[model samples]
Target: MRYTLLGVFCVFLIFNASQTLAVDTFCQETKTLIVFGNGIMNSEPEADRSKNRLQELLQATLTPDEFKRLEFAIAYNQSYGLLRDLYESLKQKLGADNVVTSFWRWLGGRDILPDAVQQEFLRVAASFDFSTRVGTQDLSIHLALYRSKTLEGKKIVVVSHSQGNFFVNAAYVALHSGTDPLTTNSFGVVSVANPASFVAGSGPYTTLFEDGVIAAIRAATVPGIQPPLIWNLTNILSGARTSDWKGHGFLDEYTAAGSRSVNKILPDVIATMNGLQQPPQTVQDGIITATLTWGAQPDVDLHAYEPNSTHVYYAHLQGISGRLDLDDVTSFGPEHYFVSCSKLETGTYRIGVNYYSGSGPETAQIQILAGSSVRNYTVPLPSARGSSGDQSPIPVASITVTGDTTNGYKFDIVGGL
Candidate 1:
């Protein structure tokens, strides 16, 4: 069975092998990439709640034109509320001192939990496919954002909250390590209620002195973990209150209009977008985009067979209309594809992958953004020597476009891959 982990975002763009997607030279010269990395949430409802709040804040803050120029996405990481409740129960049963000690140990890079507790944690972790799962999912999501439509010619400002800071930081490192120096200038990060010592992407992180979680982490003096800079009285006065009891809610204490964090974030985002050199080319595709990222194994290929029987892949970079913007023959790919907005066709387009060659088994992830809908598929390529033909590659998904270029195309996920 094939399952999906959702990496939500609005739109991403990509150029050629440089791994940068672009917009047509004639499109908006500059656009904003507001990729939100949400904090720990028991459920998606809590996660989405913050995104909605942030959206509201952005809508209210930016001018009508500014808001329209924005592309938003949520890099959601799973947090089990039940596990938190379980830990509390365990704390009560085993004594808070022991639970706290075990937690600090885990934080300090050791897992010395009692066997029963460790087993439970591992069981739950497996159920969610945490380590092997979340790591790749986060990569795909942010890479999608990196190649998103907003990033075509401008920088991307990641506004990450709480645990999201950790994810964003890791992603920033991974992307920077892989891309060119110019790509580095195309990315920025803003951290809030951060618990990590280091900020990613030239960060000026935001954390309240009154924030209990960060305070506790700081009190522990965990070697590598430190609280973000303390906010001054003037800043605190504007954001002392919070919707979350912890004073860490993304909206209530951080991004709400006039809050110090928002004051810091908005200007930083604007500065990032404004302080960069444009890419060599820019092309907009509000129509469709598919991004592929895989594991350590090398030479995974992304194929997009267009409705007009045009096949786009490593062998052939451009089809009748779609373009394979990035092709990676080495390990850990982010091969991308998209149909130019101006030449969208009306018919079914199939997406597939081939484990062209590799050291060992690899898991391939493909994220598709068609119109406003985003879908993610994870296919485990157990072996190598895969062939490329109309049906040789393992099918991932299919997208059907209705309407026409004259009226604007409507993209829909037709059915199973």
Candidate 2:
């Protein structure tokens, strides 16, 4: 009896020691990478499967070096949340087939005035319960960060998409609200296709997120020492982008084929992940990307006119092959345009710029990329002092895709991002 008791005590000590060692190991990392999944994606068994799948997707697709750096944890599972509730409610009311369709159509701000059928669906989606879910998601993400008590002072970065953006912002507010931004440098958030108005808007899909959501995201734009960059990669313009299927799809990321699929969204993820440390390695998505940065200009716009004579500026956002991924006016400029060359008609694609606001002749550093070819253009973007409408754009450079290579299109651009 004495021997058995002593053995049990020894085992208990070993278990506790192992657990402590595990936590210490986790804390060794300088920062934490947390991924917030999509709606209907964060439930028990599904969440576990999705988490594993997400990790596997990243591991499989990301370069071996990138995969090595991909140390992430699941912050929240939304399987049983308010969005799920809305889904279930919609399913019952309009049947499963129409739920996603109606929601998406309404979401993209289409066909609302003529069809009264979707109004009820919108009402249901924007109900009180969804608001409660956002609150719950906020706390849930906060808990994920706080639970790692061993890593108390480590910087936290949240990778969120779609509705997850709202949750992540709420979590940021919860975590860093009363604290000193300069001191803790608490955390940074990366949001994709945030809808920007999810929690705030009403009426239609385009105006879906009203006041509250807008205020929250606008607040997020305020530059912090830790960098509060909101990565809003909108349309993919190719024949049904990976996300266009669900509209909000390809929006969480790291997945192989879902809306925020790794292939479609991985490039941006690569840029953001390597943003803090070593230089980023671009993802090979067969698309030409131009990212503009002018420290002096707060609101400069990027425009890409295709060989097909279609323009993709802020006004005509969607084109034959590419889309204006983001139009940043409120903060430092990183206005971008991504072109899936598969849809290109084979000619010189004209790249232009508009010095939208805050005075220019601003030295704009433009980075253009296609496959392995990257070039940097330093141009003096002329100044414009007026309303948002008069964007007097100037044609800056061009990318000529002579022909096709094995990897979609063999192309060379005038500039790098």
Candidate 3:
């Protein structure tokens, strides 16, 4: 009787435990997101369209939850504006075949431009060097990746099209050279209609035969380029007339419904989203962190003045209590600075912004996170190209900390805007 009672009690206990301990089913936040880099947009508005279309497609394809969690952004390369249209006209006059070949050759570091096309090339390009322009643009791209991965702990996947590939490649090199080896794994690329000899970050890329740009490049250059994905031109054109007449458009050919490029690109992006490693969120790793971002404005500088008479800016990156992590010179800046969490300093830290270089006045937003509180300020920066000690940085806010890291830190923020 005693043995039977013991067995019955054990069974009852097991049943009760099973009923009480229901598994927690909270959804994990997605750490991966996508950023679109447009190629050869004629203007800023066109660049906006390219990125918007990609975002729309992703929104339509991904599950509602997935789409919501997968944040998107655009790295808008300054438009060629009228120069692009002029170049197109020149390409027609000089024969697309000759221009494409020479362009790729020049990009490949070849010193010699064929004598026949050299004069025309220089005239049409108007001394506009793609590589040189992209070199500057890469700084903004590098800062974006750093802000996303190293600061926010998010994985970044860049979907680059045409000329954007060059920017991605350059930015990848910069990011790799500066960051930790493990940090590079936080980035990947999906090259679309790529004209570059190689894709950066070793991610999957797709180019189609119907893409006249790639076709012209292939016919003119050597065999280093990836063979285009074969697709029936008649079928594609007949189905939809949305793509560019030359079939080199990002929205019309590559991302459009039933497009071959999308077949490869979507899966590759999803795989990368799953495969990339997630780093710990370090945005708040410091006791006081200030991040400044602006619109199409080229250069916006972030400055942090510590109470100890130490100033941290682009010129002086490190201070006694904090350091400037990134300084952006190209369009759409995210100049970032932070006070070390370990080296908590109890004093007044002034946060300042400077409209270093831009076309006109720009609205700047700075978010300062300190002691579990975040304060955001939006201030219109005048069109003034301020350098080190030449023009005073516009004071945004001041934070006064009162305690050490041992017990807990207290923050008193004073607005200066």
* Candidate with maximal TM-score: 1
Residue-pair clashes per candidate: 19, 24, 0
Q: Measured by TM-score, how close is model 1 to the native structure? A: 0.68
State the lDDT at 158 in candidate 3: 84
Q: Write the per-residue lDDT of candidate 3 for residues 282-307, one digit (tens) a residue.
A: 55334467888788877888888898
Query: Across residues 47-165, which tens digit of lDDT does each residue of candidate 1 receive?
Result: 66666766676787778767766666677765646458656766766788888768544422235447555444333322331222346344666665565543355457777776677
Model 2 agreement with the true structure over 1-417: per-residue lDDT tens digits = 011221121112133332433211010112335454443323443444545655676677766544543445555534345555656766776677876666545433343422333433344323323334567433532443332211223334455544555566566556544321223443555554453333211111211112223223344443442222233333343233332222333322224353323444455444444453321212212246666656555777777878898878877878887777567776445567766534545688888676677754676656665544555666675666444433445656788865332223346565421
Badly placed stretches (over 4 Å) of model 1 are 1-30, 59-65, 80-140, 147-154, 178-182, 220-228, 233-245, 276-286, 293-300, 313-321, 325-334, 355-363, 382-391, 403-410, 414-416
Question: What are the RMSD figures for all models against the true structure?
Answer: 11.0, 25.2, 16.6
- The window of 10 residues in a row where model 3 has the poorest summed lDDT is 1-10
lDDT value for candidate 3? 0.64
TM-scores, each model vs. reference: 0.68, 0.38, 0.53
lDDT of each: 0.63, 0.47, 0.64
In model 3, what is the error at residue 206, expressed in angstroms?
1.2
lDDT of 2 at 271: 47
* Greater-lDDT candidate between 1 and 2: 1
